[model samples]
Target: MPTPTRITPDSLRAAARTVLERDGRDGLTMQAVATALGVRAPSLYKHVRDRDDLVRVVVDDVSRELGDRLDVALADAGADAATAVRALAEVARRFAHEHPQGYALVFGPLPGSASPDRAALDHGAAALLEAARRLVGEEHALKAARTLTAWMHGFTSMELVGAFRLGGEVDAAWSYGLERIVAGLAADGRGRAG
Candidate 1:
């Protein structure tokens, strides 16, 4: 077969994402991406070193995508820092619900040693921290961001697996929980002020 010349890292990532969306993480193999690209599996090695490299690229791409979405949400939130922070959480939750496997990969274990993917993760994280810093002040920004990330990840992960079996509405619970956390942070700020 003639060598496929149009394949790029973004295209490979796109193929991986398609497989991830349709077949879960386990199905994102180099061969699968090659098949998706209508090329031989070895053809992928020119762009990616191996399976781990492919995953790293995909993770970086997806992390950047999530960061872009969060940035848009934050920008749309205007001057209300509290609302902006809450919007970050809500956007993260929506992203998780919309792409469970992709979310899992973003939050999942690394294939090997860290690479440029860490920067992508950091970029995604910094957006949340900056929003949190705006809301809770620099002194408490990291803690606040960590708290928000924990709640968002923990709650969304549970919700994804049908872990919330109670009769109460999950969305209501999520909103209430997020409100309490945001309120507590505000109260904490006030407490420190006085």
Candidate 2:
């Protein structure tokens, strides 16, 4: 008789996420994930091709989750473009803070040629583009999205590393930066619309 399957891709990814969160990227090994799932390291190869493949799985999952949260935040942000932008940024920041390792994995450089799920990554990008479209019209939406993502990524990366050693209400600094970007985008939209 064939042996019963013990681990699914979902379970493997879940265990991998736990390992990543607890031990950071370097600690996320096949053995670690297998241990978390109560399986042997070799057993993980049945689900994932290798360690890089495993990381990609986790990355894809995190990307999808971030996209879902961004979508929900956008939905609840009302009709104001600025508010929508703020909501999206806040959601991203909170996600980063809550899942620093996962956030890094999603945003960090990938190993080898492995890529995260394109659809999953695009879900979040689409949400950002929608917000940007509202703020700056279709012509400039892509630029706005890129700009906002760059800012958010930089800020969160720094925050994650505790690089903001200047030490004066980091929350306020985040608000200040976000407001400036929103205002600038709104002004650009107005200027372009005129």
**TM-score against native, each model:** 0.93, 0.95
True lDDT of residue 118, candidate 1: 71
33-128, model 2: which lDDT tens digit per residue? 888988779988878898889988998899988999999999999899999999999999999999999999888889775588788889868788
- The C-alpha local distance difference test score for the whole of candidate 1 amounts to 0.85
Cα lDDT of model 2 overall? 0.91
Candidate 1 residue-pair clash tally = 0
Model 1 stretches with alpha carbons more than 4 Å out: 1-5, 114-116
Write down the TM-score for model 2: 0.95
Error of 2 at 147 (Å): 0.6
Q: TM-score winner among the candidates?
A: 2
Listed per model in order, the count of residue pairs whose N, CA or C atoms clash below 3 Å is 0, 0
Q: Where does candidate 2 clash, by residue pair?
A: none
Weakest ten-residue segment in model 2 by summed lDDT:
1-10
**Cα lDDT of model 1 by residue, 1-194, tens digit:** 76556897678888889888778888888988889888889998989888888778878887998999899988899887789988999999999988898898888877574244677988788778888887788899999899989888999999999999977999999999999988988778677766
